[model samples]
Target: MVKFNVTRKETSPIDGQKPGTSGLRKKVKVFKQPNYLQNFVQSTFNALTPEKVKGATLVVSGDGRYYSKDAIQIIIKMAAANGVRRVWVGQHGLLSTPAVSAVIRERVGADGSKATGAFILTASHNPGGPHEDFGIKYNMENGGPAPEGITDKIFENTKTIKEYLVAEDLPDVDISTIGVTSFGGAEGQFDVDVFDSASDYVKLMKSIFDFESIKKLLSSPKFTFCYDALHGVAGAYAKRIFVEELGAPESSLLNCVPKEDFGGGHPDPNLTYAKELVARMGLGKTPSQDEPPEFGAAADGDADRNMVLGKRFFVTPSDSVAIIAANAVESIPYFSSGLKGVARFDIVLLRSMPTSAALDVVAKHLNLKFFEVPTGWKFFGNLMDAGLCSVCGEESFGTGSDHIREKDGIWAVLAWLSILAYKNKENLNGDQLVTVEDIVRKHWETYGRHYYTRYDYENVDAGAAKELMAHLVKLQSSIPDVNKLVKEIHSDVSNVASADEFEYKDPVDGSISKHQGIRYLFEDGSRLVS
Candidate 1:
């Protein structure tokens, strides 16, 4: 047996290591700095409970971004040195954020070990390359991003971190293969296991949805489908699930090959970023010679965000979740009789503060528990852990349920497909199938519609942005002043009935998150947030 020695390398804290809701993200050059990644990784291990590190299993993988291979090797060595009994890596160092979560929760090692945490490396929807962005975030045993309490500890540890542990003599394990490599160490034995990236996630998906029904819908001549992975990590699973398992035509997949640079395009699954998919769906600037498919979808870099589309139509994320929540009980079998045996009217739905009130309307009509949480997914994770939320989404193209703690892009696509299958169960051979647009229109007709739009001002000076937020908060002191300002902007605009800085109190944890954003409630059901 080969033996490896651990070395404690002396290091100093680097400035600007603070992590946001997603973890540390920066340009590849920034992460390439000496000890930069090491510092953050060490800080994360320090923030976790000692039991979670020593003699525990951890998974390390991410979207096949530019530096992901190197990051995976580094994290493996670090995990071994930190006394982690085993480290799991997805084959070829590829795993979507949601896949990592699923692996952590569902995958068992050959040695019968379960992962307690994971280091997910990807900048999500952000662009990636040598000069673009890179990121590393830690997920807990529950398969969710670390809560604020743990992240706060990580940031503090990063500030004062003086050293990191690594097994410098440990040869890099080949992450391209699916097998286990073991080594003897001072603590006992450290192992690195490389496994298939999609099996666990696919198995989970199969259990939640009726693939035969979705496959039947796909096989129907009247129901055409197209999916674009945007050359991101979603491509890794798209072929297995959508094509091999669900029986979609091979040609229906676009950019189904994962690329480190996302094929030199931004991997955000929106109308602007997913240009090729939009064009194929008949929503682009130039029309195609052939008719568009009945349904289309795209995924971001890490496959945690999704955009749903129909022929020449886009489904807003806010409306997507509401429609899913409204129909989940009937369409998805898991919602009707899985997990907590969730039933109609027993479902709980949630939306981020910035998301429109579309989901709230569904909740009211169904008499389901509803909550408006801050933008972070951790808030929803808390509710799901407490069995308080069954479905949740954000306006930023994220959607999921208690099936997994993290938002799941492919799962969202599968869910929409399930709904379509259920709606057309008896009509697959009819002259025309029920389209995505039809379902959305029916939802609006039943629950009324809420129009939502957002404008972003990026790269603003920090001080100016702070001042602007302060100004918005300050105006909330006087409702009349806000109303007057609204009227001044546009006489036809509705008057502001009330205003306040958004604050959320976690029902499960009783943690208060203040100043999530500034919101103005209108006389009608409309709302404006900043």
Candidate 2:
């Protein structure tokens, strides 16, 4: 039945195919290179056994970036050649990273089929375009990023990849149309299913949150909310959820149109990158009493990252997780049965390197368990899948819970809205509402702030960074010498209480991940100043 030629072109090993915790991300040109994306995709299939690749339903979709459409078609053909049962693509090849995870876990087809894994194409908050970034990553059936075991194998396969299989005769299915296209081949009957991108994800969000309560809050005149998608894929869901489902006005949504190049702006959601949102939130140097929105937020390129802000105030991601967890019991309906016992109910608060220490205080007050992991969301996902972590986040504007394996941007916004609604339920008569800053300040006063700050030493030589780390480690061998050096550097410097390299073991999986980072604790529970 296979008529067209499907050749296996011999290729040598290409460099830099290794994926990090999430996926392989590179510039659009790099991915556009002939056979570069193919080699990686084949290697991913090679990593898994033929049994796994054959007759398996896989998801292939991502943020509507520049190359996503082409990549989806290529992957679909490859899946057919590899004897994959069926392939699922989001409508118009658009699905956020979190949404992909949700689809892998919760999505069900009319034929009662489910996805085994997904190839999520995204570069996260990285800018996109012909010259900017593009990416692809694999997720397992549990709706989480593939662990190191599979990624390591994939990298190994990339190094030795010789050829890849593809169904050359299979015509390109129209991804824009929401329907199924079938092709018969030697492998068997193959199908490419294109479906609505937002319905399954929206249902998941509604199950976790009470839309009516949040809608009432959104309708209150005293409660004004703003969302900016940064021209990313989040725009597709923002309208369906915020405006259509929650009754928010259309004007409140900024940059709610998905753009392949993100309107020539960076898609990362931070103070510097999210310039439009920062300006609109009245966070300029000379703050004015302008009629700014009460609450504002932005999602990164793939909609897996978020930045939360209030009138002139910005909420740190470290504090955001704790605040969400502290309020989820009363605000979010999903936690009603409730989250308790770190092991039993997935109550552990897994934090990464730069997460605030204030979370520890909240965990103690709430009787929640906690773990300190390296700077990667995958580590938290591991604990989450093992039924240990319920809520976790990073300092880099990432937040998610056990509801999904990925950090969800829209979910974070809804959590904040829920908290606001719960705290200001009695203030519907145009009275003063409980503000984001007020809640943050109350949290600070109750738990005591960490006075946390970080510095970036960019463009530093790798050799110099290594030498500095070695010198710091050597200094740790003698606290008195370290303190003496510190005093010599600055007269007002304090003595070091302890210094050591950070190491952690996952309580759920009992896996030890080493060389996390170095922590130099000063006498007053603070770190040494550079």
- Number of the top-ranking candidate, with lDDT as the measure: 1
| RMSD of each predicted structure | 1.4, 2.4
Runs of candidate 2 with Cα error greater than 4 angstroms are: 1-6, 286-289, 340-346, 456-475, 528-530
Clash totals, every prediction: 0, 0
Q: Summarize candidate 2's per-residue lDDT along 1-530 as a digit string, tens digits.
A: 33333557677789999998679999999998989999999999999877667898899999888999999989988888888988999999999999999999998877898888999999998889999899999998888888777899999999999899887777788999999887787656778899999999999999999899889999998888889999999998999999999999999999989999999998989888888788888986656566779999999999999999998899988888888977888888888676544433447777786676777778888777788888777788888777778888887789998999999999999999999988888886655888999999988888777666656675599899999988878888999988898889997876889988887777767777777778788886767433
lDDT of 1 by residue, 1-530 (tens): 67999999999999998888898999999999999999999999999999999999998999999999998888988998999999888999999999998998898877688999999999999988899999999999999999999999999999999999999999989888899899999999998889999999999999999999999999998989999999999999999999999889999999989999999999999988899999999998988888999999999999999999999999999999999999988899888773244455556899999999999999999788899999988899998888788999999999999989999999999999999999999999998889999999999999998898877676689999999889988888988888888889999998888888888999887899987888888998688888
TM-score leader: 1
**Weakest lDDT window of 10 consecutive positions for candidate 2:** 338-347
Model 1: how far residue 525 lies from native, Å: 2.2
Cα distance off (Å), candidate 2, residue 337: 0.7
Looking at model 1, residue 20 earns an lDDT score of: 87
Candidate 1 local distance difference test against the native: 0.92
TM-score against native, each model: 0.98, 0.94
